[model samples]
Target: MKKAVLINDTTYDYHHGCEAVVSGIKSSLLVRGVEVIASCPVGVHYKKMNNIEKAIQQSDLIVVNGEGTIHHGREKAKWLLEVSAYAKKYNTPSVLINATYQDNPAEFDKLLNDFDLVYVRESESYDYLKQRGIEAGFAPDLTMLLSQTISLPEYQSRNGIGITDSPKVQEGMWNFQMAMKHGWTFLPVLRSYRAEGEKSATEVLRHLKHLFTNIGWINKENGVSEESYLRARNRFLCYTVSEYLKKVSGLQILLASRFHSLCFAIVTETPFLATSGNSYKVEGLLRDVGLSSRICELSDFDDIADYNAYSFSDEEKIKIKEYKKSSLIKINNMFDKLVGLTG
Candidate 1:
């Protein structure tokens, strides 16, 4: 069996960027009969550099789940360089899969310059690679690959109105209000689930006041054991808001600030207004899928309803499907290329 090592340098939230990429890698490698061993388990901090090195030594290939190399300062980038050097020392073939360089250009070039394969998640990363003379190619988020393994909610009954979160929440609500005027059930669903301590969701709700009708918050780091996860996974109303996702299935329209929340909507094929934080990673994913236009500016909050309606168009919806398809194809090709390298 082809043993692969996946390094997930992230806090094990319920759903995170690295976890998502790892999921994609797992699915792709499974198809090619490869076994993967992630160095850090979910919710476990990876402080042991020795363990990561050992995993790399035992594997036929190494995959650094894309979350860019460094951020804030150069601390994470430093760690990444250490790991990359270790991989090179052992001659372990490494693949940087689905990464977003949310870092300084100089730093990104330095960290990503030496790699067997670098699968970029956005055009910016690809262009950056070109400028720096690094071997890199653009690919979509692994969440798109979920299309094959997961069943999304069917668009069985799309209510005329769709409510979203962020400042653009008003736009979705206004549309829903219009639909409600015609006798429809119009409710705006907002979810908040960061590793933030208790009451984060409540705080957001309090801030939103009466704008949001449905609110859900989940802090996954609190309890994420095998049994706890299973229970949370199986619970009808896990974390208070999962019920909405479970009930709405495919028909719920989401306007979200969180990445995984948006990802949940994508896996469900539920149309949404992805409220981008101050991060290029989100925008990169949106651009890859041709849905960049669906994002709303924070400044648009005052007249969110108007802004959402003004900016969102039929063209954006058409691009969603196209981006999804292209993302999957790009990732599949990356996997095929990596598998060939190992063989």
Candidate 2:
């Protein structure tokens, strides 16, 4: 049987979006008869893993889940890229997929060039790789590749808007306050299990930390207390990812700040309006789907009624349809090339 090693595997990360990406990648390979022998998690030193060296040495391929990791000269990016070098050393084919490449060090070009193929999640990264003379293709993030695995909603059944978390506290504050001001749902992109009832002492401490850290912008308000934000946040917390996705899908529109939330909006064909994320990731995604005009400034949030009439254009719908269709085809071709199957 053909064997493969997955580097930067994020299935265990517990973020619903991360899990979707890993699951899509894994299932893609599995259906092709590739047995993934070793999956090195994010932040782990791929080369130092005791069994990893042996796995790659005997494997037919190495695939890196470059999801949001290969930019800004991060140590994790360096470690993950070194897997390609190891594959080169062992004469095994290597591929990097689902990446957002932006403002990265020029040295990364050399590392990227080592890959048998590089598939970025957006065209900005695709253009960057092309300029640097690397073999590359661009597709929707792997999160979108899971669209077939779930149910989507009909337009007539959807109503209201939802705003989700942001990596930036101030951005998160804007989302939270906007949802409250507009009487919209504040969906948390972070997944947590609530079936166990009371959280452990450790989880309690984490929630305490989450509360304190989340209070930074709220203190400026006259009547808001530290616990107020935490209490409000908990009210809408979801017990499962499927439930969360269903909630997002039911929205008439999503005012999102997280990259994955935007992906969820696209997966459910929910029209979205977004703000900046930590990087160009959000803008890049909107650009990919031909919805670049949907990115709004904070001032635009003042009147929720303004966006009440917002929805996808006929042209934008076609662009989204093309994105979904072409991304699936590109991803299929990517794996065929990876495993040396006749394309």
lDDT digits (tens) for residues 273-333 of candidate 2: 8877656878888887788999987667556685557787788778887888787887788
lDDT of 2: 0.75
Q: Tens digit of lDDT per residue, candidate 1, span 1-343?
A: 7888776634343333334455567768878977886555432334475675677778888777755444433565555544555678788887777666654546656666557787877786677567667778877667666666554444355443233322243444343333333332333333233222435666456434433323223232242334332222222222323444544343435545556556656655666666665457677767666777767753342343432243335776566667677767787888998877676
Worst 10 residues of 2 by lDDT: 190-199
Error of 1 at 103 (Å): 3.5
Error of 2 at 157 (Å): 0.8
Q: Candidate 1: lDDT over CA atoms?
A: 0.56
Measured with C-alpha atoms, the lDDT of residue 104 in candidate 2 is 76
Clashing pairs in 2: none
Q: Which portions of model 1 miss their true places by more than 4 Å?
A: 9-11, 16-20, 41-50, 68-73, 105-108, 150-153, 159-252, 299-314
Best of the candidates, TM-score: 2
